[model samples]
Target: MGGQQPAEPATEELTIDQLAAKVGMTVRNVRAYAGRGLIPPPRLAGRTGYYGADHVARLTLVRELLDKGYTLAAVERMMSELPDGALALGVFETLVSPWTPTEPEVITEQQLAERAGIPHNPETIAKLVELGIAERQDDGRLRIPNPDLLRTGLEVIKLGVPLDAIFEMLPKLLDHADAVAKIYVELFRSTVWRQFADAGLPAEGWPEIQRTLEGIIPLAGQALVAAFREAMGREIEAVAYEELGVAPDTLPSTG
Candidate 1:
């Protein structure tokens, strides 16, 4: 009879083979990890060993670390230092990952040239790569890590802001941006990280620390944008008052 004898219950435990298949790992690797004490030993029922959700979580984390290029020894070190490796990984990822997440887009060299309105310009492409607006691929195409940033830069160039001038200002702009970033990071380090450290990094606190870390990125971006907007408005008003002899208050608002 081909009748499915009712599906396995959701919370049913898995055997070694079932666990291996569930997590996409070979039984051998699961056994090896278990032997190395990377995962907790399975529950025993007479002669049979059973694994549960905890085993799944641990194995999944191990696989994720491997995929992220961490060596076994490094992962072991991490596991030893942080029993809550998954939570720690969450905070680590939030801090190290790009604040502005975007889907990467790749373009052929011809497409790149067309977009920037500069035909056959390797130097321009190089500059774009240098600015991190694009990455030159092994296959001789450009990978735009941030397509929106690339489009914004192209629009600036269209507005007659010479690419060379933008390139010239880049170093100073980057240095200033770096300084601003340090200020924000320092603020967090001085307050949040310091308190967490002083508290001996209690297991109960990592969640709050991780949430604060996630929040700070958008907060920092918003603050920077607001500050820059205010500064730019003041500078433009001053320029109008000086050059056109119009009172700063009398200038017509573009908006």
Candidate 2:
């Protein structure tokens, strides 16, 4: 009775409704999360259960990670070994946040269907959602998570290419890209971040690293494009000779 005060709110104890509202979670979700140990179980206070802000904050983190394609099991592991907020925010800004944009543009399903030149069937849209390429908003609208990739898919479809072929190549392409990206990441970690930490200038390092990487990327892209063109030319020549019995010298050359 003495603990229940009129003007002073309990900082350590929040009612279920207050907890849900504060954490941006539904009451059902908060209870479910408590049951699943995603967040710590609330303490019993007489007839009412109460949670604290730490639980609310942790649950919010779990929800963010889930929205970023993390499984609950993975989130559990991450929560167990949580990094400093600065590092977490750095990673979030650098990697996770770039994938999702918040600009709202109104477009009908028919517009997307017309753009892709395919009937927008429920199954196809669902497949895109499941693949994490697109999202369905609570407002009954389709959110194109990455318009560039969607545009690429549309172009591929326009060229009469089957999605299965693209799907097969996509993983291989992404694996190669990831491998290349890791080299630079290591370079940054070793050279830039390490140097910054050693010099006690860690706060200023990431932006400098970002600037250096920004300069490196376009040059790397041009080199990659040139290498791919030459390599693909050689491949086409080899295939032509093997399959068609046509030598490059024997064919009419373009001047």
Candidate 3:
């Protein structure tokens, strides 16, 4: 077992600065999260207000999720779901973290062109930014928000797929991704998350919730890939048969 985190006793009084320092956060950030109702209101003592361990737990979760690339709005939404305002760190992480984790990278304009085999032009960069594949930081550099996606794009480009074709595909792909994401979110929210919320977030339910979610995340990812493989094969084969007048049954077996 790892060393136990030395958290403040539940009843320990903490000034705003002390609480911020204890949680390794800035006072401004703590207040911002508090304003968003991501944390419980501090207890007011006439001219002074004080935070406690509850604040620590909530802020810690918020900060951790944000560090994992979740937007603040998303963190606020997830925190708002917990009626009891308590969380198991592992369960929360399992619930929200991306299944195929991607570490983002920053690249120069020329590097983007070199790696992606595209021209180092403003129009080309604009297209990438528009596609949500890259982001333009204030420093005038490009950040690949999803490096795996960039790699995939580069592979497609290497196969002689024109950037225009890729650009055309990107929107449709994004639309489908959103649709698929919605389906999974709805299924899980309706079947699992809501039930947990309805149950008043029982203390004993944390472990079970964590285990169930750990299974769901990767299973969903695998399911998407498998389903797409099957569907893609079918679509391509249909094109070969219908458009190209190829006999499906006479084709050589790929497997």
Candidate 4:
């Protein structure tokens, strides 16, 4: 008789809730993806279904691709071609998860009005939505995507800046920021990421690449602040000396 085959390793199984939590997605989204065939159907045991490591890895890959601007159809096509073991949830977690100082906060319309120091006016809420500063949910609660920015805007309003002026200037500020972001992203892609890709993107260097990307976040913020200050200083000096009729030599040193 042939020797009994070695027992296969036991695989860890996760319930639907566990799978959703592990992948940072909602249970509804998990079901939607499964229904759309973007993910493999979970194994059934009795009345319940169970997911495994492959499901987690696939979900992470899907999220990463979507975050990179791929459409759902494109994501489905790409996911179909990925060979088994091509993705690891652990690696993708470190690489794709955002490192941010702020988390989204949900507030009722009344609470939002109190925060903004305004009456419960639909026009004001509409303006906030138009600026992409807040979103209105089906439940009628407002979602502030970044509390820091909301606080900053509220402070500006407290400083007696006209709300209309503030809203008008915000779009211009966003436009400039978008351009600056593109420049830095392109710089990184053309330099560090390009070299890594040229090297065939070795798995060994992935951690280093992730660290480098994380390190650049704060550095980029500092650089932007420094540059903005310098430009503002130059503009103030120009307006003081030329437009305001003040002598350049009489100007106070910004240093």
Best by TM-score: 3
Deviating ranges (above 4 Å) for candidate 1? 1-81, 96-98, 252-255
Tell me the spans in candidate 2 whose CA falls farther than 4 Å from its real position.
Answer: 1-108, 202-211, 248-255
Clashes of 1: 0
lDDT of 4: 0.80
- CA error at residue 225 for candidate 3, angstroms: 1.8
- What lDDT score is found at residue 214 in candidate 1? 88
C-alpha lDDT values of all predictions: 0.82, 0.68, 0.83, 0.80
Measured by lDDT, the strongest candidate is 3
Question: Given candidate 1, what's the lDDT at residue 96?
Answer: 59
| Sequence-dependent TM-score of model 1 | 0.67
Per-prediction TM-score, please?
0.67, 0.52, 0.78, 0.72
TM-score of 3: 0.78
Better of 1 and 3 by lDDT: 3
- What is the TM-score (0 to 1) of candidate 2? 0.52
Q: Tell me which residue pairs clash in candidate 2.
A: none
Task: Give the lDDT of residue 36 in candidate 1.
Answer: 84
Candidate 4 total steric clashes: 0
- Model 4 C-alpha lDDT per residue in residues 24-67, reported as the tens digit of each score: 99999999988987778889999899999888888878887787
lDDT (10s digit) by residue, model 3, range 190-230: 99878987898777787778888888888999999889887
